[model samples]
Target chain A: MTTNSISIGIVTYRTSLEYLKRCLRSISFQSALDSVGSVVIRDNDNGFDREIIEQAIAASGLDKSLVKVVEGDNIGFGAAQNELMKLSFEKGESAHLCLNPDAALHPNSIENVLEFASSKKFLGIFEMEQFPVPHPKIVDPYTFETPWCSGCSLLIPSGVYEATKGFDESFWLYCEDVDLSWRVKAEGMHCYLVKNAQVAHFVHSRSNDSKEDQLRALPLISAAKHLADKWGSPRFSKDMAKEYERRSGISIDSDSLNNVPRPSPSSLLKAQPDFSHMLVFSPSTWIEE
Target chain B: MRPNITVVTRTQPGRESFLETALFSLSSQLLVPEEVLVVAHVVSSGPFVELENLIGAYKTQFNSIQLLTHSFEGDGRTVSLNMGLEKATGKYLAFLDDDDVFYEHHFSSLVQALEKNDNAWAFSNVVRAGYGPDGNGYSLRERSQPFKRSGYSFLDHLYENFIPIHSFILDRDKCPSEARFNENLVRHEDYEFLLRLASKFPPYYLDETTAEYRIRLDGSNSVLDGSSGMTSEEFMLKREIWVKSNYILDQVRKEIVGWWAPELREVTEKLGRVADYLSTTDLTKRMEEQKKAQAMVDEIWSSTSWRITAPIRIAGSIAKRSPIPKKPKVHSLKDGHEVVNEIKSSFAWKITAPLRRVKDAKLKKQP
Candidate 1:
């Protein structure tokens, strides 16, 4: 039998049980997945609905033997990806796909990625449109020619990941993709946006309440540190500093600021809620038909 | 008011005399640092003991001199400064390397400039020195410092950094509380920190010459001869920032939007222009005009008074002393000078030389 070519690693952090099920169902029901490699779900959340998630996995009706679910140490996104890269390297997998939990690839997305990969070697980011509300040309992940592959639907060749030493751990949340793409570019490898491959990223839904708040706040803080690291921190103007604070609300509170690191990976995984709230804003099945 | 300046020094091999002279120059100056903290990185046994002795001798004249030593944390300049910042108890921070000296008016002038303007974090024009066996050479010249353009907005400092960090006095309290010297960065760590700081504070220009930034070819860590390779930490540091700059630029765009919405439109227009330029392989007439317009923008940046004006002032000295052709010769034209006497006598001699010489000879023979 021919070995599987691509292994997909999805980090499901605080993803709703319904969304996870639907996402898994979409992946498992893909007609092109027979030659697909293993699907490894590294859960960064404190806990998840095992019965519901497992049942959804079973209902997708793909080969159950091809699945691997690993519990992570709650070590943020970059660290988790690094772990995936290590595991894939050991297994001799040819390529790795990093997918967000809320995103679902179209039926031909994987096939197209593979076909395009055969012609040109690259780390691919799929052309993404928001789910339920598609802008067809909304520029969120990149404003210009996509500089780096987005983590939402990134496809990485095994060689590129190893040579660049994976993503940096210092970047806890935001800019990890930016960091990775630059590293890939530095190695003389190109980062491509596979316009042919389509994936729907269900970004910023009301169901992901707590996670969204954390995501919004953390990205701003990381962004300021990123600026500080790139430009000289000592010369930041009052306007510049105020602008960073205005966007993120992370202030220079001497009372709150500590030289200490955040406590060891708090897995504040609350019970996954019913994502029926999304249906309120989302179109009905009849409407879709 | 006295500006509390902190001088950070790390002892290297065979540089004790230079360090002592640097310290003595500070001590002799009427306006010295409020407290000079010498944070020495004691690597080997060579000249560290002498540094200790020098610090011990000046314990009384100085304002609470503290000599702290760390057993070399793998040659990271950013890490060293971060460590110094943690221990520093100063209102304003000024960095001076061990090999450099400050003129007598350095501290007073910098402090005066800072006092005059409250909105400004201080920076000064530097005099680059070339010291050798004959003391400060002809290369000892005063010039305006180059400030970073990344901090500027339409009229304000947007995010441009033009001054070298070592050449400025930064307000400690007003500085971004979360800012750090990317201990990971070996090369552009200072640049990185300054960019962050510039994002938060408006830097003031001090046009006066304050300190001598020494460039001795004989120093232990001379830019030309320093052979220390990148540490594993430094390599990891660059890897960290290379990944971070783009991520930060994304944030930078967002932050820019928050303060000045107009700048975002301008930046987007610039990006559009770049994108349009990228599409055309050969420059069309329209594209050529756009290129010329871009060149004018560049010329405006280079010709700005506060920006590259220092080089304009130095061009005269550079031209005269320059080994290149086409420099006009300059000579002293004083009335009592030898050249003047030679010029005056040459015309008189040509007018009456032979007759006067023959008459004098005839008179002498008769006598």
Candidate 2:
């Protein structure tokens, strides 16, 4: 077995420089970052200059030379993450940590998660619990097995990423992680929460910026429709399509459902996506919302 | 006045790491603060040195991050806050405790709200999060909006403090003298400070949860925290602190907000009775709490109802049944140093402290 050297992928939109700097600072403080892992910032802004991105990285506390900053057109989130991880794989990193720009990891987060992941016979996807606000999803207290993993602070082993082929790019923003997690499980791999690790991720839930909210909400609704269609749940798909039209004020035909991609027949037989519970899609939740 | 914010962050020795996170939070704010003041209430120079080194490492991110070391003999939070308040040079003042955090937009949105309104201070909504031990480090257990943010009333605030310290920003020009925190209260220092500030300037509530209030249940830092890992001795010490807090609050309550609603005092006294049910306390400690309570009352009285409102005081004096003393010693936060030069020497003031407390209590008894 190879030593699991980690590579981090931070998919950034027009993220706050302060958030990015603090995020970088958090990762740096977690021990010797340079030796154990590499940090990559894959920018998905419409037209952010490379210089501006470099300056932002420097301003954020990272010596820009140490970080690999990629800049170009808005490639969408799922695609950017996939691209970064693939690049990391080529560089021989055993695992990829999909970190959000807004996340601040606890100093022992990486070390704890790595230790836990290595203890298992077959490595799977390990998710770091969000601090200050833990997601209202279930993760077994003792075993650390979760129904699905949120990509906000997820760790994917090289094998799992190669098998699942990363997040479905059809999902521009949300629900992509759920699809990928389900696929990982269907492939007979495990998914879990690294019980001891925490990453401080704030969902700016109460910020009254309707403009940004609208931009964020539309993609989320669109992603829901795509996810539902991919999972072969007609009811959820139809409902999400209707919701998309109502919320986005755009009329779309049933064309979106047909364009949805699918896995091989054998993989579909293994994949079982549950939509029984509305909003939060899981059987057991540790904390109430 | 220019709209630069001076963020005051008070931390003790153990919370140095948390303090680093807090400074990073400040660094990421959309509205950059003009200054950052970190008050370390360490009894020994060793912890203070560690804090100094830590702050020095992060000094590149902040042009002006000053560390003020305080050797507070008692409950240190309020005194630490007062120390920050004294040195704050920015036009507007904000506070972020070491353990708590602010989102990037926390300051920008607050300052924007303050700019739009005539109110001296504006507060954003803050969500409370509970964290516990997970072996490697503390992990968040749950989160809740424990405080009601709508329809803020200063009268209602007297009953309970719903606002977190980091949630609000005050314009120094508007409430200069009223800015000091009551050093007496061990637990609810932020609440006590808000009461005094809110009494004068009705804060503009921004109605957004831009900051977070974190509490650790596994015997960690923060108020109303730590019972699981606390040993019997630790529990008893914690119990005594709470008792002193209750006793001190009761003392200040009588001389401060107790005038308008005497019934409220009765309710608090009832709560005090409930605390008394727990254990028999030390009389010497009670006397110490009483003295601290008098100091708190003095701080509240010092948060003067504007000296400009003399005519109203004269008119309202007859209706209240008693007139104030001929001389009311008013101290602004900035002029805190000149009190000795103005009147009684430090020696005379120390000796007559009991006599002064009695007189102030009588004056405060009038609504």
Candidate 3:
């Protein structure tokens, strides 16, 4: 296997098949496909879309043996990514990329992100900038270090993935990447962003369904509770508890939050988790007060 | 059978790039419109070959696609819109600008809304996106809801346009012949038509944002000369639109809601009390009157006659250490005819006016 090669992992749950086909088509057109050693897709909808995805892969111009689809039983995004990453890492690929199913890569996106990450061994996680709606999290121009990298097009070396022990599956849905990045930061590693790399991700559908919103809110608020408990931020914890109760009508006691996993006290001190802002932790120029 | 939905897209001759996205959005619709009429504004030079070629590529996606060329004497979007509507054979009609996009469920949701209701038209919520050029096609700067309404109100419609033109789908049979766009209107022709149509048949409102109104900050869009962000050209265009809107508003005969008179009668009675409270409580006038009374007493005390009468005042005074009392009361400020003013100025004066101001402000915001 190539030393600097990447093993791309994509997780899909009730994703548009058209969007999936488009995503694979974009990857097949990559200028640096030589750097991609393996590709694994985890279908979190119990292999419902596996046949369609397989057909898409067959047409995608990627090697039939190199790309494989695995069935998943609706496991959460972070957990699904972890499973896919493990499979690819076992294949001896040097780097891991957790790409969103909705995202389509630019021709040079993989080449640019890999080049940027190659020069920096201390990089815990690096990601391509999303096009049309780039993440507004601030990046230091001099250092190219952001508060955290988005899991939308996350790229990290397999060694860093092992050192971080991958994402804490307790996160289940959102903010797992943030927890991972903070943990990486605690170990004195930087999470960098590549502006030259661009991925097209436009799946922000505004659903008027209150039930669907509530379903989304549960995982989000649960993750928030975990983040607040682990980071020792009373404000974020209190706010999430209040919101979770308001939305779900289920009160979460302080005792329940203690069950959430926490970093060591020294790791907590080093990570310096900022619960000041909602999504992006450190002070960022991109987001205005 | 025809799909019964006609998407009347109004575009300029040179807008092939933006028109592609607009067409792509329509093509991607869950309930795709079978009929698409692309009405382009053209000069005497005839058809836009590039636009025709672009439409040719998407002909297989749509059921029946027609590229219509319209040449009008005056400058306005009404010409293209009117031609599209006239040529439209669908029972339902909709308008899509070259720059905007419909969500997958946009057509399906609004169609459902219209199907359920007896309304002449139905509108779904539309979000506005601020777009700037990235290395890729375009980067969305931000999304904001500049126009969000709970429901449709004909009275509120008379005041200002809260609905974007593309957010709505209108029924052809339910609409009267008089509900045509006012060609005299250089802008807000849709608003003018909506005013007339809504007066006759109140529309239904779908509470889902099914379309995106893109304001290209890259200056590609004429609506916003979005160079270096949302520029002065946007404000300038709005200024021009409002000025034109004034003319459009005057052209239509607005109905005076006759049923609200009974409620207005109660409002008038409350206003009378507010007027009665305001007339008596002239604050500066009362302060002046008090000052004048104090000065008169001071004048009398400083006079030689007052000095001569000091002995009588001292004899009359219970505490006669000084010729003058500590404070003089103003009797002249008391108006016997006005009972409202009889209440002492300190407590009633402060609380009453503020309450009335709140009352009047509430009344002003009623519409």
- Top-DockQ structure, candidate number: 2
- As a whole number from 0 to 100, the lDDT of residue B344 in candidate 2 is 29
| Cα lDDT tens digits for candidate 1, A55-131 | 75785555788877787567888788778877876788888888776666655567777666656644433333222
Write one digit per residue (lDDT tens) for candidate 3, span B1-367: 8559999999878888788778867765656699999988876666578998888877766789999986776464888888888888898899999988887677778988888899888988887776644334555556766567666765556655778889999888888854568777767788778877777788898888888888764355873222223456765665576687675465463333355534654565456445544665878775676566556655544544335444555565646455543334443322221222222122223223334445644864585
Q: Which runs of model 1 end up more than 4 angstroms from their true locations?
A: A1-4, A46-52, A123-145, A204-217, A220-224, A227-244, A247-249, A252-289, B1-367
lDDT of 2 by residue, A1-289 (tens): 2356888898888886666777877776664354446788887875454555566666656555567877766777788999989999999988899999888776667877887888874367999977645676666566888878899889888888888789877777888888888889889877898855778776656665786777677777777677777777779877877877876788655545565567666766666677766546675333433
Task: Please report the candidate that would top TM-score against the real structure.
Answer: 2
Q: Where does candidate 2 clash, by residue pair?
A: A18-B28
Going through the candidates in order, state the TM-score of chain A alone for each one.
0.71, 0.88, 0.89
Q: TM-score of model 3 relative to the true fold?
A: 0.60
- Candidate 3 residues lying further than 4 Å off, grouped into runs, are A1-41, A45-68, A89-146, A152-165, A183-216, A232-235, A242-272, A279-289, B1-76, B82-93, B98-104, B118-120, B128-146, B171-180, B214-245, B254-367
True contacts kept of each: 0.00, 0.29, 0.11
Interface root mean square deviation of every model, in Å?
Answer: 35.0, 4.5, 6.4
What is the Cα-based TM-score of model 1?
0.35
Q: Residue-wise lDDT of candidate 1 within B1-367, one digit each (tens)?
A: 4437766654453566566656655554435576776766666654566777777766644676776666655665556677677777777777666766665455666777777777446766555443222122211212213332223343233333345555677677777666677665555556556655665676676655556566532333353123234475764665566566545543553564475645765775566446545655565754565555545434433433313334543574577785432212222111122232232223222233335446644763582
Local lDDT at B216 for model 2 = 61
lDDT (Cα, tens digit) per residue for candidate 3, span A125-210 = 89788654457676755677888888889997887878887888877788888888888888888888887787766545455577
